[model samples]
Target chain A: MIQVENLTKHFGPVRAVDGIDFHVGEGEVVGFLGPNGAGKSTTIRMLTCFLPPTAGSARVAGYDIYRDSLQVRSQVGYLPETVPLYPEMRVREFLRFRAALKGVSPRKARNARVEEVMDLCGVREVARKLVGHISRGYRQRVGLAEALVAEPPILILDEPTSGLDPNQRRKVKDLVRRLGEKRTVLFSSHILAEVEQVCSRVIIIHQGRIVGEGTREELVHRLAGGRRLLVQADGPAAELQAFVGGLPGCSEPRITGSQGDFTRVEASLEGEEDPRVRIYTWARERGKLLKELALAEPTLEEIFARLTLSPAFQEGEAGEEESP
Target chain B: MKRVLVVALRELLAFFLSPMAYVIGFLFVFFRGWETLALAKSFADSGQDLNAFPMLYAMGLCGQMMAVLAPPLLTMRLFAEEKRTGSLELLMTAPVKDWEVVLGKWAASLVFFMVLWAPTVLLLLLLQAPWLLGAHLAAGPIFTVHLWVLLAGGLFLAVGLFCSSLTQNQLIASISALVIINLLLWGPFIVARAGWVPAEGIWRELFSQVYILDHIQSSFGLGLIDTAHVWFYLSTTALFLFLTVRSVESRRWV
Candidate 1:
């Protein structure tokens, strides 16, 4: 329900968000993956009408971000990166206030919606406490509750689980998954695992531009090119590498780690085939012990690093820092 | 309008819940009461009539001093604190209009300003009650004088709100507002008294028009509702508030 076309934002001469184009379909859970200072927050801010883009335009929920900002804002609920909240207000009271500020009406429905989101976000226990007195986990959940209070059709959450403990992170991830089932969700994060688990589609942004975009499997298969085999054997390292490299559909093996006489090596496999059985059978025939032989899936982390850490991206980051 | 009231109600609730507002209210009542009683004692000792009482009390040095000092303190945190804490992002992204946020804050501060003045005005009125064995008081001058206070206080608070919008530092906001209020309240009087402008010309007439002391002492202090002075307070308050709204809008740009 969001359309962005050639959107750019500049803080003076620093281009926080360069010209970028992307669209999020209705009910699609899109993960905006980018490292810090990659313009993720700036893009979300422009979409939410929090910051006007320096050039280009966007339409959120069928409303122009510039000409119909109020309509777009009413349709979208945004949780900023830092989760800004009034410290003096109680959680319930704060949500109620946000409800009103978002034009939640009938008073009774507003209160009911606030209560519902409080329960949905698991913030009912801390509802009576002052926001400042609550822990960070509670604060983050309260920020989520505030966004859901108005029952908007679209959600733009910027790093929703950035500072939470593992348990809290899982809880928020699950909540986001559940929320995305009914509403369009565009969440940004640098955490590869979280995005891998939560988002249906991933868009990787680097240096204010979209560097990679696809499903997790598509990205892995496209960038990784082949499957990986993790092999551990108690044998001479050079001979073991030569043997594994000579196998069918297996490329040259690289020694990855070691423990005593056991050497851990990883080999890239070319075609769709189970090489585990072949490796084990061949090692037994050759009078060599195979400690471990398993096919391992390439992780999103590796793919993300390969895509985002290009030499050009690093040089651009260095140049940006040195310019001003 | 409804959204404006919603924003205003939140700000009003914050002020009431803070200990600082109570402290300010107590200090204002205590000091203004003491000053009133002290002035009354002086008048009685000199055998001067009570007819000049409301005029002196309303346009007196202490009233003007409080006017200059209290509003900046009340309005300093209105925008600056929000900016510092990053809550302005949440506030601005809401479905409400920019002017609504500005007006809501200004409205809340104006309400609290009235709250601060209520007890003092009640005390002054109480002194005129029959049970206190006090003189018969004319209602017109008393009402007009307090109206002047409200208008002048509104202008001062608007200036403070504008200053608060320009920075994220609360101290800077309060200090700058104090400077501007002091200048607005006393600048014309000082310039005219020092004969900086020509004595008899359009420049001198313009000085008189802008002179707050003349507006207070000759107009509001004597219960005359000079439309020019009323327009002056209103238009200046609007000007500052409009500037504040612009300042708030400028946040999206930079």
Candidate 2:
């Protein structure tokens, strides 16, 4: 469990993490979504007590990050972005060292925990190889095992799937998903799909501030203003666009594509309205063959783009006043 | 204390696995052996007594130079390489304290420093062999010289670790440590030899206090256990270790 309040970090003239607030409850997997240099890593570092917050405070596992950094660190398992490791150490030896460093227990218990996490992270096969000699995927899995060696209840992984191939990414994502079933996981990523598939709740941060926070469907529904209709008919592009634009509750109808005698048209509709009947009647009266008619579903990527890149979100609350 | 040992053990393991440690160790043994043979040849040719066995072996120019050179090489990678490879993040975030990390690394390097000198123990034995006249070496002075070697190496290794903590560049760490160690070791000797300070004044007293060569030969190198010299080595070593811990903690703020 983690509670943060107005956590801020400034590197001289640059505000790496501006005033931001968020909470991660126990046994919940929260995805921290942001682009590069978006204060995601900075916030995670602060939570792990690796960096002291410049202005605000945070607490982990009921311990204050400033006064109880050691306790806070002990309570959380951290996988840093680059997955730092001693190249000379063997994989199993490195995990044992990490386990001891985390104060696992007597030698026997430490080795057992190390072995368990090594298996949990799927690093058992490469346990004897030198860390430098292993592939990147195993190195990442080793990093994960190192984090889990102590069996900390909270997991703070910064870009756990970064720099991995698609297969490795999928594997790591599944691992995180399974691990999150029992522990609180706060993982940062620029990949929306990864977060969508793995996290139950997502927080979008941009320019050092939180832009949006909710479940995937909640974010999509809240930010994607209206429903869209896609209609394909055998007609002139301009005429089809005009006809769709003239429909009740329809606006911004545009010709999206055309081929041979078929043309595709799209339009945004107001709430709770299905204009398929009206469009079918119009097409029948105009002697036009209607090929397709359906409402388009908005993806998380589109909702993220609207929240992060739109001028309304750019000026933050200031641009909200200008938006209808 | 347990955390400190854990960190120290890991560092010791890393040191043993590194090629640089072997290269430095081989050079130290090779050059020290060469110097000891030359000293033995000169004593034999002049028909002089070899009562100065410990001083020749332990306080020789080659031994002194290695003290200055090997520490920086051993400690340069202690913190600098961790920073360069981003391992310092995981290390700092671990449950261990900053002082634990600093002390652990310094202790490991000091242990390696002592290990590098282990072959000299055998060389000391070989000097007392029957073919070499079975010279009766004074054990008291020999013990003092070995103690001085440990204390002096501890201080220099602390300085090197401090320098390593200041930068991520291993070359810069080694070069800076070398400069500082040279200033501490040779600076007073050069000044006093040049006759720049008054013969009997506060400046001379100050120079005498810091003159490590004088301390080694006149006190620790002999059978005398000067608490002042011991305190000098210990207090300065502590000062550097403290500074290294502060430097490590400062990384979080930066």
Number of the top candidate by TM-score?
A: 2
lDDT tens readout by residue for model 2, A64-177:
998899999899999999999999999999999989999999999999888888889898999999999999998888999889999999999999998899999999999999
User: Where in model 2 is the C-alpha error above 4 Å?
Assistant: A224-226, A233-249, A259-262, A269-290, A317-324, B196-206
Report how closely model 1 matches the true complex, as a DockQ value: 0.70
Error of 1 at A125 (Å): 1.6
The alpha-carbon deviation from the true structure for residue A139 of candidate 1, after best TM-score superposition, in angstroms, is 0.9
Interface RMSD of each: 1.5, 1.4
DockQ of each candidate, alpha-carbon based? 0.70, 0.69
> Which ten-residue region of model 1 chain A has the weakest summed lDDT?
A315-324
Maximum-DockQ candidate: 1
**lDDT agreement with native, every candidate:** 0.87, 0.88
lDDT of 2 at B54: 64
Candidate 1, residues A1-324, lDDT tens digits: the string is 999888999988898888778889999999999889999999998898888999989999999998898999899888998999999999999999999889889899999999999999999999999999999899989999998888899999999999999999999999999999999999999999999999999988888877777798776665544478889988889988887888777886999999899998888876566678877887888777778888877787877787678867544433433332
